[model samples]
Target: MDKEEYKEERFTERCDDKVESIGGDYDLEEEDDSPVEEVRVTISNTDDPSMPCNTFRMWFLGLIFTAIVSFVNQFFYLRQTQISIGYSVVALVSLPMGHFMARVLPTEDFNLLGWKFSLNPGPFSIKEHILIGTMTAVNTSTAYAVDIVILQKLFYHSEKPFIAGLLLVFTTQVTGFALAGALRKFLIRPAHMIWPSTLVTASLFRSLHAGNNAPGDEGRMTRMKYFLLVTLGSFIYYWFPGFIFPTLGVISWICWIDPENVVLSQLTGSNGLGIGTIALDWSAASYYVQPLVTPWFAQVNILIGFILVAWIMVPWAYYTNLWNSKDYPILSPDLFREGGEAYNLTMILTKNVLDEKKYEAYGSVRMDSFFALTYGVGFAGLTATVVHVILYNGKEMLARWRSARLENEDIHSRLMRVYPEVPDWWYISLFVTSITLSLITCIVWDYMPWWAVLLAMVIAIFFVLPVGIVQAVTNQQPGLNIVTEYVIGYMLPGHAIANVTFKTYGYIVNVQALTFTADLKLGHYMKIPPRIMFMAQIISTLISGVINLSTATWLVETRPKVCTKDGYPFTCRNTNTFYSASVIWGAIGPARVFGNVQGAIYSPVQWGFLVGALLPIPFWLLARHFPNVTWLKYVHWPVLLAATSNMPPALPYFYTNGLFIGFVFAFLLRRYRYNWWARYNYLTSAALDTGVAICGLMIFFCIQSWDGEMPAWWGNPSDKNYDHCPLGAANYYGVIS
Candidate 1:
């Protein structure tokens, strides 16, 4: 039997765990492969008068936590909503949602009991929630952290003002959700990717559901305990930095202390490590990344991320000749007419006014060259993905069929443990639902065109799907930013300059990357209905959008000083990050005239891709036996080499991140698990981050107000009288580090 059939058998019989009799309300099947044991989950007891009470408490707690997190994020950034609330809440709340969803849609009905609270069956079970939530949350967080922090803040410094920032986040996320909605059925279901995250989350939910159903054991030991821990842990994590100390976060800057850096440091130009306010704790969390432990393996893990990034950046510098200090001097001189690192360093000078000089960056090319690459990769990935699917996973698909044919026995758990394996039809319906919703949303929001919505769906179907799959397979995303940029370039047709239409669509690409990666991760976890998971993300994101809008509205009207003069909404962590990247990248994209001026020089990806394709050609000649040194590895090696060349400083950030991952891995993977590390470490880390970030943001807001103390103190004279001032200013939120 293939994997699907094997899984079905395991879930049915010859497996041992739940000790309750499911009676006729359940179904079972046995596979010859192993000893059979029944795994039962208790459906909520609808008959009990207290059923509503249980649900009320669970959902009530969930909403409270969400609100609290939103409040904290708002206070720090001066805008609430779109708050992460950490993955734990995402994980915890998902279970309830999953169970509730199953009941509303399930094919069968049954009743079951838990410790103190009995679970009722609508359709599926809590297990689905756990697996789905876990998978999606990880990738979402990963994509959020890596892309937002690095690309946004480090790369593009968005400059639309506070309200604009809110709009940007809202628009982009909605676009992604809409796109995911379009592709959910085609890619999510039937593929049975068994997204790792969804599976595990589902497992956790099953444990809870089953434990509740057991005669002697009730929800008391299970639901109450876990729920309390999650809440207590979440609260403590939020306040830890405030009450106790701070946690630090980091990014790498080889040029900061590099002597070469000082060489480029022109009194009139933006120079030096370009590092100052970012590293130290925001309030208590070190703005600078710091880790408690540096494990042997973490070094390797960080090296991997660094390698990919460096390969794209460093070699291009060498090949393009940007590394030579005496050559171009892009960093020095009164670079920006309006100053500000965003205006000064970026290829395009979008400052107080469109600095004409910045737009003239690329030599013969416009900045967005990646569009062609994306188009090419999309085509290639699409063809290969389909073929691979048919070849590699075809057996399992057939087995699911055979199991269905042989007996109507294989189905959703009696107590709704796993959600009924979602059928493809559901996914298709979700796509249609989203398309219609997006159109409705567009009309209501007046943010996008009707045709634009249709085109986005097409793009999602053809391009984003392929990219999402690749990201799932190898933790790397072939982001379509360049592709979309090019599309915008052509459709919006910026006659010599980037236009508004381009800018509008550009936001969607950013959202697409964020959404795709999150979904991939989510699917990896719970085995939740990709269709449903897709819908949930949309629902949650929409909720986030509303929150962002309301907060931004509040900030704009009441705290207009902070919103405009102070960069209230604009400076919120990830908001600024993406804006920065989009502008910088837009400059470099092939579509922009000067985008490629230094392309061969500074673009690691450009040279890396070329180098990757060509590197192996020569390696084959160098050693006949070195077949392993082929293109993929060859291309990857340079990226790796470039990544680690600037390693040591960035080490702290990656190591700390890994400390959590390691803690999780160690606790989870080690047969005899130390439950405490598994449970509390994540909570502790979350608390540490919340406290630190909150403090820093609040301080930043205060300092920016320059209410009296540091108004003039933040002023600087050398860098074009730009008044860049202390790091917390509208120009230097980077200094919040």
Candidate 2:
């Protein structure tokens, strides 16, 4: 397809009057509507080019928040119930701080090397606010590479040099920046790729700056006021779930009815099927799925998948004793032996490589029915993503690829053309540098082979766009970890470090790239300079990588029994899961677990790839044939299959509770209370997240950190199993650890 033809087919001619007026406020009555209704309402079509973005105030505040968020997130990463302090929290906190700095800092200009600038740049502009958000967004979660470091140090008892780990983290974190930069034309500049999650953040920023005094907004609570009030209420209410009456987090009344009945506990416990579970805590409900910001259709798809896998498939598999499921916990992240004992890595390894003789004696590594099945689902999710995207978005993607310089741009893209674009060489240079460093880190440190590093990058490059398309449309990403692990496990069977390193590079690079792309889309919508956005992302990624590794290293070294169950709240749930993956896919290898080897039992699970690839075909055909059946179009196979991806670490209650809330807000409230939903939906989500995060941090520092314990009672049980299901973690065979 030629550029003109592609442009004609994909987009309408550029309307200058709609977006060319600089320094004009967004007048909704006068402007043309965006192709996306969500974007039309949530984001402004107009731009103010005079607004300053790359300011001294932005850098100062952005760096400070980056450090704080990186440390806090990594600190909580080791806890039993992990809570992330998201970018929305940063946006809320930074607003007043930015204004305070603007008020206090001297406006007097400073000259350096013939260039002039000021510490305080007039009033705090929305551009500066967004730049800060861009910076902190990169640090929202702990760097993915840190998981490898933690896996090795805490589980493997072999820590790589600080420099090696640092380079590994930095290269993996920033490599995606290059890919995102290259794909911006397809993912960001286009109008239809709304990146639904960003709209929430954008709406929050606009509300903070635009104020509540807009002419028709009388009697309605301003967004900022509403956010603050909800935040305070959430903060106060979290104390019960966070500490005092912890049972409120997961109220499994069915388990309470008969804790002594193993079958009932397995069916209804917080750690089991979580039947009849009610999570009053926002943190518990929103841990895996962010219900408020996610669209109703996507949430429904996820809920369907969760029900199939968790509620139906898993229970049936356990009761039927599939792959010795009755011998292990009904749902657990822990790897197990033939007799339901924890798989000891030390017994199976000799100098960090699996020993054939020791492995023969130690028996095969196993997992519960839920964990094994989730891997199969993951396989399906990956293939389903590729097929789903090709079916749904192939034409547009092909057109975008053919049209190098798209002429028919959207209002946001057109407004963005005024600012200088980040040069392609900038991304190319960074990409090359990061890849070289990654290869060196892998080969020199013996984390993985040089060819494995290249292969990992290849996998990431291949899957990133398809997976990114899924996340862009629906706020869920199907991960590459399962694919990466399966491939490298067969390739390098006995190397644990190599397997994890390969997975990190393959999975995290794609994830980080999508994250960077999402931020760029946010910048495009808010009309920030592209060059400035690039700078913020790179700097924040680098800083956060360092902080994440440092904090993780510090905790592992200083906190005694940090990863052990006896460590109380410090029990490393995620790190343990990472270690389990390393064992199944690296040290023990998939051949010994899923192949025709001596102990192999679940080879049938490998058929998931075919299952996943074919599942989308029928859905696509049905949607095409029955064009009038609007609901047929919403059957997203990728989202549905990937729904149970967080199963072992995230229990069934999380989905059940999150879906209930999603129905209330995304469906019922969105349809019944359009005005309220439009105004406060995203804000409510942000406020809830912020409140939970703040309350969690305070609980740790003020009470938990100092060994301040709550008095033992019914709600705050001494056993600490808040659901009161004592036998939930036991196997049907009566193996209780």
Candidate 3:
């Protein structure tokens, strides 16, 4: 049987008799692959007797947590160690806070004209907590446009008006949210379109509400107890790797044995490519690919591709001296020249515009071979997603479109049919409002021409559907940033600010759209009214955008050298990487990097798109022609390419760590210990993630931000703190070959 058929069988195998008994009230086949052993669960059953949604308490709690999560997330964004609340910590805390409001506040409802408002209507419903969590999740991370603003200020020494920056952030973020709302009919209403991550959140909600009055919920009670134990254990265990005993996180035995060997350090160190390393830290393991979010099949594809690229390809290319790799750091996002000096971006850039005279004198920009290869892989990954979508999911998408038009009897859609949808006009109004703001912000700041802003919005609108389809189907978002930059670089060369402006609008708009759509689905699953979901998302998003932009501007103005090597916890690693991207794709333009004659040094990487487009055809043919070879089904080329795309920010051990955990939890435990896997797999992920976030937050507030240091000890070695790799440590000083 094919994978889909196998999954269907697994889903129905144990529930045949119960499914027949439940009849129309419950559809076993339509449920998500949930660990909850309930045989008859129905998405269309929205018969709720609980408190009404959109109560005043829901909005109150959402605003409070919005400020809290926004502060924490933006604070961490500038830290050397990148961390965010994401969803787990917020969910963990919000569950109790939501219940507290429900219990403590008065249940009296007051009428204002024809509308009713209440501090508390009754019991704190699960829907209330879901709304709070969804809104909080929206606020936790700085939107993508803030990165562009910070890059311009920190690296290029350029700044925009405060109003312009705020407006840009809001427009880019909400534009996507609006577009996602537009795609709700296509992406959110289907029962079969289950987001695996959403299932974990739903299960957590159930566990939280599993009170003692239930007669036949012993299993749920036990699961709740198990969750508490694991969460406490995880919280305590995290201290070893996160703070006091840092070496435990990066136990590179090979690095310890041969500490000064450049090649060995590069091969085995966590900070380097980490080719043959072991990360004892769960935080490190989940950094690249979250264990709870990614499914086993997806993880398998990533593992195979990582082995081929990080393990085999990178080491060979570096050791063999491809692209003059020996003269530069084995892995970094920084740029250099042929003579092994840090590329003098200042000399080449006059007032943030590339100086042709200085650039020609400085010679061609030299990228570390592997870093360049990632861009190649990224392009290939982008192309592969389009091809893969066309080949694999085309029919599925067509069926969904037909079902959507027919107002099909899919369980989730049927459940949602009761509520009044936030009309299409609402989404259109938001889109139109955001685009006008975007155009005004860009033109006012001279960030980009008015026409470029229009072009960007057009690009964003065009790609959101195709990209949204991939994310809705596969849970992977193939970014448009690279492709968008390629277009702007060629169209409006030598205009760095405009280049970033266009790229942000074109790229981040789609990302926000998908994110908003996901939250809408979460709301749909929990039966939160659609209008309430829209309000909560938009309100929280706008407030968070303002706060994030303000925070970013303050840091840039106050801490001038934030991304420097010595900045430590304030290194602004992501910002520096963003700056590098702006310089490469914006300042230099595609002509200098990819031109056949003018830029022969790096032009070859452009063929990656063609290579990526072609790579998946063979896999599809093999699967088609050899129907019995089930292993062929596992070979998803797009996923493999996407895994390689994680190389820069994620350490080399990331893929390996994902593979290890997938083997233990997803493969072995899921098969042999099915009940245990169902009960604890996602719970463990939540616990570990929350533990790390809590630890990191405490350490940052208590020690790092105050300029207090942990006392020097053997466990916290100065020679090598977290990563044992030191070969490229001096690259920050510009001491090249």
- Candidate 3 residue-wise lDDT, 601-698, digit = tens: 77878888999999989988899999999998878878898787756656677667767887888888999998767667776777776666677778
Stretches of candidate 1 off by over 4 Å are: 1-26, 30-54, 69-84, 89-192, 199-301, 304-453, 471-477, 490-539, 553-577, 580-589, 593-605, 612-680, 690-737
Candidate 2 structure quality by residue, lDDT tens digits, 319-398: 99998888899999998887888878899899899999999888778889899999888888888988887888778656
Q: What is the clash count for each candidate, in the order shown?
A: 116, 0, 1
Q: How does candidate 1 fare on TM-score?
A: 0.54
Per residue, candidate 1 scores C-alpha lDDT tens digits across 237-287 of 533222222221222233234322222221111221222212232221222
Q: For every model shown, what is its TM-score relative to the native structure? A: 0.54, 0.91, 0.88
Each prediction's whole-model lDDT (CA) = 0.36, 0.84, 0.73
| C-alpha root-mean-square deviation, each candidate | 11.5, 6.4, 7.9
The residue ranges of model 2 lying beyond 4 angstroms of the native Cα positions read 1-45, 190-196, 403-414, 465-478
